[model samples]
Target chain A: MERRVKLLGTGKYLPARVVTAAELDEQLGLATGWTEKKSGVRIRHYVTTETAAQMGAIAAKRAAEAAGVSLQELDCIVCASGTAQQEIPCTAALIQEELGLSRTGIPCFDINSTCLSFVTALDVMSCAMAAGVYKRVLIVSTEIASMGLNWKQKESCVLFGDGAAAVVVGQTPEGESSRIISSAMQTYSEGAHYSEIRGGGTMVHPRHYANGHEDDFAFDMDGRKIFRLTSQLITGFVDSLLAKASVSKKQLQAVIPHQASGMALRIMRTKLGFMEQQMVDIMADHGNVIAASIPMALHEAISQKRVARGDCLLLLGTSAGLSLGGIVLEY
Target chain B: MERRVKLLGTGKYLPARVVTAAELDEQLGLATGWTEKKSGVRIRHYVTTETAAQMGAIAAKRAAEAAGVSLQELDCIVCASGTAQQEIPCTAALIQEELGLSRTGIPCFDINSTCLSFVTALDVMSCAMAAGVYKRVLIVSTEIASMGLNWKQKESCVLFGDGAAAVVVGQTPEGESSRIISSAMQTYSEGAHYSEIRGGGTMVHPRHYANGHEDDFAFDMDGRKIFRLTSQLITGFVDSLLAKASVSKKQLQAVIPHQASGMALRIMRTKLGFMEQQMVDIMADHGNVIAASIPMALHEAISQKRVARGDCLLLLGTSAGLSLGGIVLEY
Candidate 1:
């Protein structure tokens, strides 16, 4: 029996402050328009007082409200952020606390595979719902790239943003069956070094913090290398995923991909033969929000009615693991 | 219509170097036998040439071999460590890279709720298997606690070790119905600060390394606080979990709680009415391996014939999130 799942509601939270390319370039002493031409991100949001957990809480509350459910009704919370605010308690637990629902006693944990986390988390939540282990699973993806970006790395720093997105997952209504039709993941760890932050972990202790390389503590990327590798790998990944689900690109009402870069999205759109309108690209405004990008874009698509009831949606992304993931589901 | 899950096999890898309490005491200028009296940890393993991902890969291979499956046959790999080797590209991805399985592309990710991670990973894997999304899953728990231990804090420094444990999971074949009967988790974020390492995460930037507090950059613990809280809350957690599973403590053939401390286990056994023989404790030799403790203990129990086929096994633990978790399964 194929288990069905539905997005009861979707929500996103962007920080109040938006930084334009001109402002960033001016601050960094780079030429104006450099960020836009290089990364295709004109403006991106940055949190001033807001934290990752706080943004996630706001997104969660909105999702719960839209789902027509109270916070206490969530059977589980899965946090899929690329970065966590702390190392001790999982971010999901903190998010629960931030939402004022701390003692509700639902199982809270985190699933991280870097940028692919949200899509991967969706797979885990889908399976949990299918097995009747959870009636409603709340998945939250929040990233604060602003704090970790190396201002010196113009290529990556300009392309990143901070935000959060969330969804309340549950079974489809009795008469309707909105199930995850298929999913697939392909990890090529050879490209693991393409994007990484080696510090802020055991491999590079704070005791040796003074021995830091310029890029070790902050997010860094070999943009050209990753672009080349991803462009080569993404086609097979998407094809195999579609074949597994027996889904066709022509059948999809919308394709929500990781808002990685303007150039990357163009490659994806052109290669997949997806129409300009069919592909949802919010990168110019939101930039690459790391793991938060996909669901945030999905929330926007749904809110704008670009996606509606009975629409077929495809979510895909390339993560820091050099991993490619895709999920085919009915809205 | 309960979905059944079975332990296909288990494996463990302890680092080559073993550090005795006397050695640590002398190195840290502590009185001899101080560690033994306080934590009941006599000896613990420390890594020299081995890294977390390397040890994890070795354990994973053994688990796959024992299960009569090749690494390639596994549908997914979930690394459930409290601390990551690096911040980006999760430890699971790194393990995949090390095992020479870089491009095989099965879904790989990490789940963490601190020490309860293995048990939590089991729940996630069981649900995935039950839903038929994955036929076989590999779960790895590895900790490099040695690298983060605060040598000045003798209470916590001597209580931890470095090791890895892996398990191969799948459905019980044919007529056998061994499966996860039930489980439960409770997180109290009020105690979230009871034990934590504030550095090596987004909460503390490496740039602030020079401003490190005496305890901020390394593992610090309020041992008495955690012990007191666990003693107060564990009996209810175990009871609630067993009740939901419709089982009794008397039916459990073996209980493998996290090898946190000899003291914590004693409190658990006394409060839960579990016999000394019913529980497995390897803390004296292995010390507390953080997230790797429970599975490593289970691996030892199975290898030593303390637990066998048809035995009702219970896995449980207290984690840094001030979370309590348990799983009842007949193996």
Candidate 2:
């Protein structure tokens, strides 16, 4: 019943356009320093000349290089993101084409769990890998959150950035301990509307855009409700995750969590009984990249050597489904 | 090395409003019989009183009933559809809410491969089931393709309909022959743009909808190009799939395919060597239900006794990813 998939390599890509908190304050007409103080995001990247698929391909290429594997050698490509590059063909195909694997015939698809997409995909695909369905797979999380932000909602508008991250995964080598120990996810759909962009879907077609429904096209979030919901559930969720993995809090050397917010991270430290030093907090620089947050933070953690070989790591997040997800893995 | 997942039950739902080709002929200003002759569709359903999530929930309920399982008892809920009901939280969460299981805390997410989504989800989730990830899982493919149809594009416009289908799956019993024999998918991303809806995602945000980009929000298809590309690949793809399953054409008692088009179905028979009787052809009444097509046909196949216990069944399709996918299962 054990999953023996290994995290072969990781990669990340931040857009070239750096939008500082100072710039956001000027754009939103907020007082000087208000943006940084409120959002805890000093600076974040936004897409200027790049598309989500382009960012994903660059990150995928870097991941392939890090894994010492060629893009052509990957058996499958999965785009694990909340947003798609386009509405059709799935983002994975676009990324495959961008990586010049158009003719490689690599199977391409997507697994979406909104902001928890990367964690969800890793857990699901790890089973596929463990079952020998695929030998090598590339999973990418790419987001362009700026395009749909409701700028009028200052509380949520300044909390997002655009970026992409990718990982190459395969079977664990003979002596390596890399494997997914356990994963647990639960959806509280009552909070589904606590955060949403109600447009660009069948419910609100483009024909309704000019018909007094334009606001539905923008992202809207009730941060307080999300916080309240998380506070009510996260403590027990972390206990269940650690219990399922048969690992204690002390066994976790690093926590590569979704860069949800500065306040969210502090809650994990204070309420979830994790030490501050065990957490990988990148919200100050990258902001909330939505589905890209966890993997992006993971790549950063690896570069910083927060987790070493055979070390236990915890990945946790709260997504728009009102979903709480966590995975315990051995690096 | 074999996949031991079993198909427990299947269910489908078409909307209450049935649009016959004659009705379309009048609506589009074409002569009577023109629409039917061109598209080979006699009648297809279009949603009038239902949302995609609502239809999906109905299908899921029926599937659970047929499987003698309760909705609240399933381990996971996955929406395997091309079109979402909304832009955030993922469609699975919406369906979860619609099912009145908001408090059940069942994990929910989505797997998308456009028109082949159901087959892809079945293949992927089957691996998870085989790996002891979950005891029972429900996959729903619900699509309201009519909402995004480019009515101006006559050739592709008439080929779609709205519908929902679902299946409940679990581990095969020890003595049962039910199992997934093989699954094969290949993406020729060269055809990625041949069929697409350019809006609804980051690429063409809603802000650009009124700025002479209205057409970009609609579904567009170069039918001839898609036909050309599919024709160039399907024959070998079928062969590879059958070979992988170690199944021969004669061994497959049923061939459930994505009702992509009437002509596409003809190619499967004439070029791919599947007998007319072995195929489950429902395009005449349902048109193409996008991702819901295959599972809808699958449900029909079971009801009509086209596939019996211990029978071999093939699920095949060409999706917008320019992706070709097929799965051979023991029914």
Candidate 3:
């Protein structure tokens, strides 16, 4: 009953338009350097003409190329995203269409756990792939957080960017040591309301807009509460995850976190006892791209050769569900 | 690699407000009997004060009771639905809160394949359960499609209602014969645009609301195109699915199909060769509740004793991806 799953390759895509903190300062009527100091985001990408599916397809292609597999060879496509391209068809279908595999008879669907989508999908899909339910599966995490950002909430608004990342996975070959060691997810819904967009779904239908519920449509977050709730639970959660994996923090070659913020990364290095050099920090550049954060950082880690084959890697993230998700795997 | 998964229990929920086609005809100012003739719906439920999560929680509680498992014992809760309760946090977490399990630390997430969501999640989760990734899981398909219906689109508007269904699954006990035989999903995105809600996501942000894109937020479907495309592909899809399971059409004890429409159900019997008595038909009562359709029908079939233990059951549906998904299982 040994479970085996390998991370074949990873790829990421960022929108072409870059919005700098300095420019945001002018747009939001803030003083120079205030936006950067407050949000710790120097620059972040925002989509202009590109879309969530288009970015995802580019990343998927790169991942397939990196894995030495063709998109046509994929057995299934799972879109693990915080945001959707449209409401009905599921983002994965749009991505399949974008990849020109619409008629390939490949299965397409979506998994959502808000910002932790990629980590959760990787965990679940690994189980499926290892069980021989599928082979050569593609998972894409795409986000356009900027689209839902509420400029009024400068704290949360400046902390988000638009990006997409994708990973190709399959069962390990006979000689490869790559495999998922352990994964865990816990939802603390008591804090679910701490970060959310109240509209765009059934509860507060769009038709209510004529009745003056526009604010419900915008993304809102009480950042301090999320930080407080995450701080209280993450240590125990990570400890339990590592315990299940029978791996120690010292054994991990790298830590790929959700790129939540500069402050959170610093807390990981200092408060959580992880070495600064072991962490993948992209918040300053990419900001928080919601679900794309973890995989995008993983892609960066792999490309930079910071994480090598057979090395233990820790993937962790706290999402809008007030959920903590972590995966320990041999890369 | 033998896979065994058992559906321990099934439950469904509908709002107390039942609107008959007569009522709809009066509301829309249509001729008497005209609404029923076009939509093939006698009555359907619409949420008044209830939310998707509340309905799902009630169904989940019932499913747990039927399964003889406590909500606290579940390893995970997966919401498989086409509609969302909110834009973030995921509908599963919301259901967790509604069930008073917010602090239970069980993992919660969502799987969306539009109308085929329940079928897809059952297929995927069965593999996970059989693989021992999770011991017990709850999957709820809760949708409030009525909230998004565009009244102007009379053809599509009268064909949807609000409801929820849940199933509890685990690895079959040693003496039990229940297990998933085979499953398949194929997305033809060439027909993706035939049914969709173009707004409320990253593609068409709510900020565009002021500029007048209200129609984008409402559900839209070309029913004739969907029927035409489905007619061309569904026969082969079911044939391949049954073939993979090594089960013949005649061997299936019950056909639990998504109650897409009364006409679709008729076509399922007349063209797809499933006997009338073998098919579970609840479209007259529930209309098309999107992702909840298949599981809700399954609950009805199970509760009515129409499908006995160890019976061969075929679950089938066509979704917004223009995706055809089917599962053949020993119930």
Candidate 4:
């Protein structure tokens, strides 16, 4: 029998410091209506360096505890982070070590798909579980997007927050009601150029800083193009995912789209023909947490009783690389 | 019946420029015999300002042509890149656009576990195929490790090169001889401190470049610790992979260890009790290509007729995150 993978637990952590739209406007000298009307973002969280990894670790620990599993039982820990604590050895490893589960023989690594990283990790872990390679996996999506912001560029700076969310996935017998049915991922590299942090990668060569070419490392973005593409792709990907999973839109109890902007979520819900009530929109407070957005939304939805047992949930995420993906799960 | 995934074609692209051990020693002001005696590397390839996405696209095209499969037929493109071109939208998306396959409806994204990324990509593709989600998947591993190196740091700089390699994986009928049998991955987050590039990721914040922090972006390595961990993990992982595949040590045709170093490969072969001829060591010329090394070696081995049909090949790779994994496949 084909083993089904189920999401056993969910948890999220957001930084304590909340930046209001008014406070951000004063910081960046931007017009007030832009943040409220265009993005529908009123406030967002920002992480101090000390709390970023700690928040991720807390979320992961809560996920394990909620799943009735200990850190020692995790076969693998996949931390999806775009805003990492270090460039090498992956922030996942550091998170694992900090969780005091370093002696459990658990393999941990970070997956980078920008905002879509967490879903991609889910897809990878799902495949491994289905293949019987792993019985349980911890997928952590953490980001301190505020840390990477060009604080001076109000256009991009106000659109991010710091947070982490995690889910524990495990193999279960077939025919289980709460299981991941199918997942789909698509990358549009052409769109990759449309949105990005232009510096600090191999392309910019950090060593050039010695020559006074320091401005090359800040985050850059083509906002208009990303907005257009994200709107088009998320809708299409979600529909395709539902089709692939043989689930219908009416069957979905909640659609958890990545919390990029409140406006974007509204548009996606409309495109998916989902009722406003059926959508889990967390962007009003969290902004774009990148990979952590969906899990954060899911955690809120579950805690608020927006999702129930045997109800279908659709997750959609898109980010730089112009990547878009969706997962259909029964919860 | 369970479907099997088979490797239909392989291709690789190494940069045109070659840096010999002598040339490197002169550049770094190191004495002779250091590169040869310490790492057993004599030469390495490096790309000049070429993005990892471009290299991956080149290799993927070649593999697609060799497999006689049009890009439109691919269900997914999994790019294994250590030196990603961007922090968002993934390098895989860029490759998809470069190949004119972006609208082919193929899902593309980057998978990273450092050097073990390609194998992880393979395992992911294998699972998707087994789940009948994708009929054809393209797996590419590309690295521009040279870009992150501190050229003055002889120990770390001498051990990296740039290259890309790709394979076309697709579904085959049950009981096929040339199929992926089993794969395993493990990460030792505790050892993450052993090797790393200190800067350029979210941890250091690319924006920090403007603040006169140049050294934060360069690659850093704790060489001795990595060497010890790699040998032990590679040996153990490969043994477990072989056991899971139900193959005895004597039945293995060849072992493709990551091309980190010639001495490492030699030692691993001896420790694992494999004949010297059964190992594919390309580091004597390529040094370490990070994620690209194994596939580059595999391409060379196949071209040289060192691997044959129906033979059992063990693929192993380990890198930062202190991650290690291996797969047993029938050639």
Candidate 5:
């Protein structure tokens, strides 16, 4: 029989400093209500001093504590972020160092699928745990999109915030309290360039930084295009994913989708047949925290007692690779 | 029962343009034969027109063809690289696009543990396959360290080259073929900063690039520090790793280690008590291909018939996270 993967606990960290949509609109000279009306965001946390890895460490510590698992017991750590604190040593390593788990010799790495990174990493950690490669896996998603912001791109800039979320996953015997059912991920790269930051990699080496456009160095988005494309495909995608999980919509006690945008969430709520009360929506206050979106929302849902033991929760989202991912599990 | 994960095929792509140590020594005005004696690297490939994703795609196609698997059969592509082509959409997505495998809805992501990235990803793919998360998986490691080279840092610059290696992994029924018997990875973050590119991240945002130092944007290394640390613990690390697999030197047919450096390889050959022929040494001609080193070396060993079916093979290496990783398998 396949070993069951269980989520032991969840934690989230939001920076204390807040950047309201109004503040950004005023700063970028946009219409006063444009950010809120368009994206369903009022205010979002923006990091003032805490870095991505730093915030991730805080969230991870809380996760480990909540799980009643010591940091030393985590056999693996996966930092599933679209961005990094640095490109060389991986943000996971830095977070390991920050959490005082450095030198303990546990394996650490990063998995990136942009916004879907959390779900991608969840499935990865699940598979590994189920196969006995690791007993306990710590997964963290921290995105500091504020630093990658392009002031000129008011749309993308105002939509992103800085935050982190973490979860502790472990293998449980059959007939356990909670266990993952099935997970599916699909990517369509035709929209790969729809949301990107072109300057952070070898394609546009740092040597050319002096002459690079701010947009190349910052996040850029064709929000409408992404919405249109995903809207066209999400229904079939979700239906297929639910079928793979052998789950019906009526059985889903809570749906934690990526808090991508106000309109995207609205479409998921309406066109996708999810009740407003069934979905976790934290984008209004947190904005879209990139890879951290879904996990943070899950943490909120759990804390709010929206999902309980014996309940089935569906976590799903869209990512920058034009990737769609979903995971169903009994909580 | 847990499925067995086996290597289906391997392929590699080396750029057409070759740069010899003599040429580099002359170009950089180093002492005569300095590059050769210091690093024992005579020649290395340097890409002129190709990017990391382009070379990776070529390698991926070759791997898929060798495995007799069509692109459509690939369920996942894990780009296990030390560097990415871009920071946003992921190198795997770009490679998927280059390979004409785009819009297929197969999941694409990355696993990064720097130079040990390939082995780390191999274990990841292995576990996922064993758990039946995927029937077929493709893992690629493509590094273009030359782009991040600092011409002034002759020591580090001459030790790196550009290349890519690809491997197709799949699960077979219990009765036939090679299988991953065991895998173990350990990390010590005390040395995380010993080798790094301090730029290209949120730490040194691209917007502040114009004022960044050349070293910040380029790869930096303290070779002696790494050697000192590793040499102090290499023997114990190897012994512990072997014990985990319950295998000994007498049971091993061949070993594939990361092409780190001439001195490092020599130490492994001598102190580790491996015969010259037992270890695959490709550093002299390839320098270090970063994450591509071990897989590329394995490709050469396979083609040379140094490792064949039913033989016990060991894949092991150290990475920038001061990580020691190993996998033992029946080949």
Candidate 6:
């Protein structure tokens, strides 16, 4: 019998401090109801810069404990992060060392496709498990978007928050039928410039920093274009995934799209004809956590009993690099 | 029958200018023969600020073409680079857009375990192929250590180079003899501090650049510690791989170890009891290209007829993150 990769456990972590829309308005001079009417983000978590990696490590530990496995049992460590501690050695390696699993012969690495990173990591780990290359894989998606925020740029600053989420994936008997059914991914490089943190790459040397390009260092976005592209891609990809899994639109128990923007989610639901109740949106409280959004939403839905065993959950994610991916998981 | 992952093609690109030990003496006043006698490096390639990413992209394109596939045929892009174009969207995504293949649903990401990245990437892609999740995958390892140099730090500045190499991996017919057999990987994060670019990461946010800490930006090394670790890990891992493959050390046709130092290789060979001629040491010309070294050496060996059909090639790689991986490929 062919082995199937199953999602065993999920967990999420958000920094302690929460900033309400009113407080944000007072701080940044935004219009009243701007956060609510535009992105439905009434409040969001903000890390003190010292807690991003710690939060991610905590999330992974929770997932592992919930999975009933010790750190030594993990065969691979895959972390997807938009905000990393360094540009080398990979954050996964550091996390592994922090967890004291560095001596276990587990190969650790990072995967980045922007907000799609976590789901993309799941796809990669699933393939590894199905191929018998790994038995247990720990995937962590952490984002410290607050670090990229320019307080003066209210448009971009209010949309992002800091958080991390993790899930443990392993193989189970095929008869269990609780596994990933199908996944579809798409990328449009032309749209990469639509949203980006332009500074601190090879193109711009670290030492060549000048203050004039402060906007380039902080998060920048063409919000209008992002909304349109995100809605169209998410709707199309989710539909493709549903069709490939041979499941009707109504059969999906819940849709977990990235908590990017509330308006984007509304447009996607309407375009795909998904019921309002059938969709799970956590951006109202968490803001856009970048790669951590989808997994954070999934964890919330599962814990709230919004989804149950044998139910089909549709996950969609998109971000800078204009990368998009969708997956159907039966749990 | 289980399917196999095959190496469809190999390609490499090295920067034009070569810096010799004599030239190093003129540039940094380093003693003659110290580099050669200790690290066995006579010359190394140095990339001008303009050539790093372009060289990597060219190698990737050549590999794709040699595999008889256009960029559109690729489903995934994994670039293993110690030096990347930027910290966001990944260097792989940039390469995808540059190659004009970003619209093909190909998810691009980067994997870094220092010099072990290429083999780790190969191992990751193998699982993806065996699981039938992707029909084609491109893996590239590129490094521009020259850019990470402190010209005043003669210990490191004289022992590095810039280059890139790529390979196309995909499904092969069952029972095919030419394929990757098995791989063993191990990471020792306890030594993670042995070699690293100390200042760039979140730990030392560049904005807090205080005076008198210039050493943090340059690559730092405890050469004695690395020498001891590399010799032991390479011999032990390669032996384990050979035992698993049921092949004897004498049957190995060629050995490709990360070109960190010539003295390290000599110690590894003596300790492992392997013939000197069977080992490929390109460090004399390329220094330590980090992740790019193994594939660059493989490309040269294949082109020079040193590796051919039915030959057993053992590749051993080790570096920062203190990661080590070995793979036995039949060509």
Candidates ranked by DockQ, best first?
A: 2, 3, 5, 1, 4, 6
lDDT of 4 by residue, A34-105 (tens): 666656678788776554557888998998888898888888888886666666666777788778865455
Cα lDDT tens digits, model 3, A1-331, are 2358888889999999999999999998999998888877899999999989999999999999999998899999999998999888899999999999877879999999999999888888877776677888999999999888888988888889999999999889998888888888999899889999999888887667557888788888998898898888989999999999999999999999988878888886676789988999988899999999999999999999999998999999899988999999998
Model with the higher DockQ, candidate 2 or 4? 2
Off by over 4 Å in 1: none
TM-score against truth, every candidate: 0.97, 0.99, 0.98, 0.94, 0.98, 0.94
lDDT of 6 by residue, B1-331 (tens): 1237777778888888888888777666657666566557888887775444577788888887778878777888888777666656667777777777756657777776777888878877777777667778888887777766777667767778888898888777566677677777777777677787766455554454345555676788888887777666666777788887777888889987877777767777788898988888888888888889988888778778898777888888777877888888776
For model 2, the docking class works out as high
Mark the regions of model 2 whose C-alpha exceeds 4 Å error after superposition: none
lDDT computed for candidate 4: 0.77
Off by over 4 Å in 3: none
- Candidate 3 residue lDDT tens string, B233-314: 9999998888888899999999988888788889978888988999999988899999999999999999999989989999
What tens digits encode model 5's per-residue C-alpha lDDT throughout B291-325? 99999998888888988877888888888877888
Off by over 4 Å in 5: A1-3, A173-175, B1-3
Summed over model 3, clashes come to 0
Report the C-alpha lDDT of model 1 over B169-239, residue by residue, as the tens digit. 98778899688888777777666778887765666766676764536777778888888887888888888
Pairs in steric clash, model 6:
A201-B86, A202-B85, A310-A331, B39-B262, B310-B331
Worst 10 residues of 5 chain A by lDDT: A206-215
User: What digit string (tens of lDDT, one per residue) describes model 6 on residues A106-212?
Assistant: 77777777788888788777876776678889999887777677676677788888888999888876568888888877777767778877665556555654445
First chain TM-score, candidate 2: 0.99
Evaluate all candidate structures by whole-model CA lDDT and list the values in order.
0.86, 0.91, 0.90, 0.77, 0.86, 0.77
Whose lDDT is greatest here?
2
**Cα lDDT tens digits for candidate 2, B154-181:** 8788888999999999889899889999
Candidate 1 per-residue lDDT over residues A1-331, each given as its tens digit = 2559999998999999999999988988888788789889989999988878899999999999999989888888889988988767788888877887765677789999898899989998788788777889999999988878988778788899999999999888899968898887778888888898887767776666676454677887888888888888888888888887787899899999999889889989999789999999999999999999999999999999999888888999999888898899888
